[model samples]
Target: MNQYQRTHETMAAYERLHLAAAEERGGETLAAAWASVVRQWRVVLAAAGVGLVVALVFLAVTPPQYSARALVLIDPKNDFSVRATRAPTDSNTDSANIESQVEILRSDRIVRKVIEAENLVDHPAFRPGVLSQVLSTLKFWDRETPAKTELARMEATTRALQKQVTAKRLGLTYVVELTATMPDPVEAARVVNAYAHAYMDGQLQFREELASRTSKALQERTEELKKQAQNAERAVEELKFSGSLQGENSASARVALKNLESTAQTYRVIHDKFLERYAETLQQQYFTVPDAQIVSAGFPPLNKSYPKTLIVLATALFLSAALGSLLALLLDRRFGGARLKRDHFA
Candidate 1:
């Protein structure tokens, strides 16, 4: 080999050696860091154990709540695009209300109907508990009549029910999700179903009332028009007969006869129109359309909706360990090294 080639080979060997030493040094640093992490595991474990105990206590003490859901379809049928608009939203009828279907479901009127039908006012679930009794006594120390007390109880129960029950339209769909949360899952299901049924009943009742009122009004108007038409026809016949008796074939007589005939014709046309409308009202009343229907009825939930135990415990443990590691690091900075281990034992 030439002098220059030998020198280059020697330099390359020294570079390889330098790279090897650097890699070994980096590996040692990584091992030391891992060991340090392993040493702090005791802190993490201690914190995690404390967190687990706290979670366990919370699970034991906290009362579980049950939730039941019911799906009510706002427009169950294709009635909206059809004559249902006239049946329900009939502006001509004053008895029918123009309230939105979803709003009607959530209204206090419908809710109160359910409460009354189910006799919730007398139920212990609706009645005031110990806390409520204490507050009521504190506020109203004076004696109150049983009647007044009953009224107050009813009002309180309604307000409480309003809070427990919720109705919301699901996105752009016609479905409305009605949910009720109560201590008793069965009661929750019953109440939710009750509310749905109440809303539907109200809609049916409203349609009936509207149809009845409209039909009655139309009948009255039609009878009056019929009488007027008959009277007009009778007058025209009398006029023609009187003209025939007098044998008056003059231009004025013909003109008078023509006017009488026109009046009778006008009355007859109006009577026919009213008669048609009355028939339609009767038909609509018989085949009344419902504003909403219970698409999916609520049932008692199998699992408690509140206080998810497993998730809570896992989250608690993870957070505690993370915080513990941070605290360990701080101690390593504060009292650092062998002293931190000594302090941990102490």
Candidate 2:
């Protein structure tokens, strides 16, 4: 036989040896196991009682957490956006667009903005959460950086905040929900509200930046157009003053004057159009609005959302029963009230 086969057979022999010992003490049948458990019911109850006491102690020590949620509606087809962008949306594009907005809500940019605006780095809820504390207690991390440099502390705080915050879309709808869970219900609600406001603020800031860039570009273009118009007008004026009618070159001079006049008129018209657009851009800045709006504000939760009493108690009871049953079965096999005959094995 191969080495693997031999190893498997050896393990199989060991299991059979243990099973034979079990059968030697009592029969290896479901009814036999159930009878053994029934016989040792007192021990099982005592073990379960002890487990209940321990569970009570654990529940007393566990901290409570509360979650608060806020809702935001994303309208991608806002008035400030380009006409082409506001066109009828395709299903694939709309779905992708909503998904992208969800990611933006989770993005570091939006998170950091909220963090800074709400001063979350200095907030009481800014520590690594319960799971991280448990892992740290188990020595899963070598060096903790939250207590290190200022930048490191900020980064650590950001990570902690990110963990506490959850951003997701509700079904396929355009409404996005942002949730924050904290030991303090008020703080949790505040954080969720801050996130919603920050997202809308970010959109407003983006539009302002876009408008600023456009204004600067238009100003530059308007100046260039004005310069061209001036040059064309200057050329036409020079041609008129050059005595075109008295010269043998009057025919050619008139033609050149006509062309220059045409050029000046064209430049003036283009420059006027740009001036009008620049004025419109400035006006639109005043009427600018965010594409996203807070549909529902977060409120402090009335009850703690974590370390539920019934769940903890039920879980402890279930585990205790299972463990007690296993122990009782083993004890019965060790020293049974009734033993089975092993004449067949012999």
Candidate 3:
């Protein structure tokens, strides 16, 4: 045979001979590889099984959480041509303003007020009736230690409870979304609804204050303008009676009368302008009240928003399997073990 044919024959015969003894573990190298894999299988199965059991225990013991949400709208109720023209510039409806409001809704001032009003720290993880309150008092002992150490500790607890709440912009329609999560669905819904009401009440109080101030200033200025107009008329009448009026000619009475007439006209015009401005001020005072409205209210959620047991269990199982496979591979390599070796089945 030629050199090429001879080389091909030798390779083929070597492969067939290797395949024939593959199942017998006739070679020392193959036997060692099999031994290593068998030794490491025990560690791999044990680690994976332990991990899965721990995961199942944790999933079973974890508490379920529920979430509720509310929505409110903020808009202007006043009618003004100037307001319409400059609404984008003057209004808080812009993206930056919306973001600022979102931040404000999540601010400690609002959040702290909500916590205090709802008495959330002392609330139970069940229904929201009187029985729930009694139950909560019983369980409070188990949950938190009595006698807070410092103001920081109290504040920290308040903030932690507050963190379970969230506020964000729903869209560009001056609407805000409020959400609260708790172990109790009813309590979550009630707290979220209470937060919405509190925010609306705050807005109403602010608007009322602004309206009162505007009304007071307008009243004072209106009175002042009326008095000024009356004074100007009286001065004109007095000048006429005293014969001090002067006209375009050499007569002093004509000239004095003309001057008085001019003064009265100026005063009347100013008085009218003030009256118009006062009316406009009254209209502007209604802006905040009408611009903002509550579009939605929160209710008890039918499902929990977090503490997903199935997902948690699946993740744990996957992670455990992956880690076990990696560890098994490493230990097998170190111990001279292999699985499904080349030509083993053949």
Top model number, lDDT: 2
lDDT of 3 at 332: 78
Name the regions of candidate 2 deviating beyond 4 angstroms.
1-29, 79-89, 128-148, 230-269, 341-346
Name the top TM-score candidate.
1
Model 1 TM-score on a 0 to 1 scale? 0.73
What lDDT tens digits, residue by residue, belong to model 1 across residues 293-340?
788999998888878988989999999887777766665555566786
* Residue 283, candidate 2: C-alpha displacement in angstroms: 1.9
C-alpha TM-scores of all predictions:
0.73, 0.72, 0.67
What tens digits encode model 2's per-residue C-alpha lDDT throughout 265-329?
99999999888777766766776787789989999999888888888888888899888989999
Range of the 10 consecutive residues with the lowest summed lDDT in candidate 1? 90-99
Q: What TM-score quantifies how close candidate 3 is to the native fold?
A: 0.67
> Which portions of model 3 show Cα errors greater than 4 Å?
1-46, 76-93, 124-157, 171-173, 246-263, 269-290, 337-346
Model 2 RMSD to the real structure? 9.2
In candidate 1, stretches whose alpha carbon ends up further than 4 angstroms from where it belongs are 1-40, 76-99, 122-131, 141-143, 244-249, 283-287, 337-346
Q: TM-score of the candidate numbered 2?
A: 0.72
